[model samples]
Target chain A: MRLGKRRATPLPELNMTPMIDVVFQLLIFFMLVPHMTRVNKELLELPKLSGTEDQQESAITINITRDGQIIVTNEPRTVAGVVEMVSEEIRRLGGDRSRVKVLVRADHRGTSRMVNQVVSALAKLGVHQIRVGVEVPSR
Target chain B: MRLTSRGVQRDRKIELAMTSMIDMTFLLLIFFMTTGGFMTIERDLDSAIKERPSGRAASSDLEPAIVEITRVGSGYVYRVGSRELTTARELTDLLRKFPNKIDGAYVRVSDGAPFEMAAAAIQSCKDARFLSVAYVPID
Candidate 1:
């Protein structure tokens, strides 16, 4: 056991390399996935409220700017175009209208007519699983 | 320099500055955690004004409450089925007071009314928990 006594002491630390790599990967993933949320591209300030949460991964998000411009996945559309796009999206989902979920993220300054028009468009398409995004309440 | 147990001289321990890095990692983790990136989305369903409202959705047997939100210049006016009100709080109170009498909650905002006002109207209707919510055309 003299050889053991002569050896240098090892650092008794857990190997964190893999854990750090995973954390970095997660951070990058979170950063990239938010773009899918399109929260960055649409500069519309959403309505603020102490709201509940909804878990709908298959929802289509439509952004309505303050000046009444409608946006779907970064492309601009008119209120009427919104109907067509939603219809296409629903058809894209295998035409099961009930499976189509729509999310409307509008600027607080957006007109009620814009909101109404979106609702009407979805209504006409027979898709009622519509969700509207609002800001998190300030505590 | 330190001496080994074998009576040989050895170098001092090479310390790693991992404490600071771990602190920063934890800080980042906390940031992402509280920011709710994990949340699917914060949204609410507005199932109003369906083209085909479900059967057994008749509000005629029960008194329906129609809320009119009108845009007047930069402000707005709130009316509960012809009875004018000023704030959404008052509207909520009115609906809450006669919960049994009101079955349908329709939000009819003027064409130019802001979404904030419309959202407020929806919020009040939700608070009242009306049986049915319909969207009426702005006249």
Candidate 2:
């Protein structure tokens, strides 16, 4: 009876060391993954508009800075270079340019000429529909 | 002897209270997860670039409404055909009153015009309920 009473008296305590380790690992992962994925996105002051649609996944992202610089996949490219890169991307998608979706994130303070040049190049490649990134105005 | 035994028992009871630490860690994890999802809350504005035949113009009545955006010193000027406007709000109101709404609208952005003006022009066209908005690059 004494042995049974002693066994019941000791409550089971959960070992939190392993759990804490796993939680820490997850915290680190969540912290690092976003930074890694955002490497391709250049920091720019995007245009704000109230009538905007939800952004969808795109096959390519072209960033235009205030100085009229264009960056694609984290590499700066000229208008012609951007055209070439987009064409290559289209070819990789089984030579179907229509299947390719392009996202253009242009700085609000940048000249329209840069965005226009990029759009013209994309148009020449038969990629008509393009997504322009903008910030949703907070009401 | 009794005092020594009590001290030993007290030392055993003074464990690192991991409950609060675990709770805080979980709270941080939840916070990071929720905020990380919002890091990229950018929306999209869809624009189309149609390839017109080399030397063909649509009929006069079938032409798309053109909104010309030009930079004027420190400010910008928005022109939808002959009517000139200083603000995007006025542009939206004018486009809303336009009669022919089927052909959509063409936003012609000049070289030096800022991108915000162009985006605003497009947004105005959308706010007016145009079926399509085309970005026209003027060199």
lDDT of candidate 1 over B2-80, digit per residue (tens): 3356323244444555765687678778866876653333456464564432232133332456677865566788866
Which parts of model 2 have CA positions greater than 4 angstroms off? A1-8, B1-16, B19-40, B50-63
Candidate 1: stretches off by over 4 Å: A1-41, A52-55, A93-95, B1-14, B19-41, B50-62, B71-74
The true-versus-predicted C-alpha distance at residue B16 of model 2, in Å, is: 8.6
Q: lDDT by residue for model 1 over A1-139, one digit each (tens)? A: 3333346556466666667667776876887686567542475677776444553554567888998888877888887787887778777889998877777788887787777777776777787656667776544
Worst 10 residues of 1 chain B by lDDT: B53-62
* lDDT of candidate 2 over B100-127, digit per residue (tens): 7877788877778989988898899989
Docking class of 1: acceptable
lDDT winner: 2
Using Cα atoms with residue i matched to residue i, what is each candidate's TM-score against the true structure? Answer: 0.72, 0.79
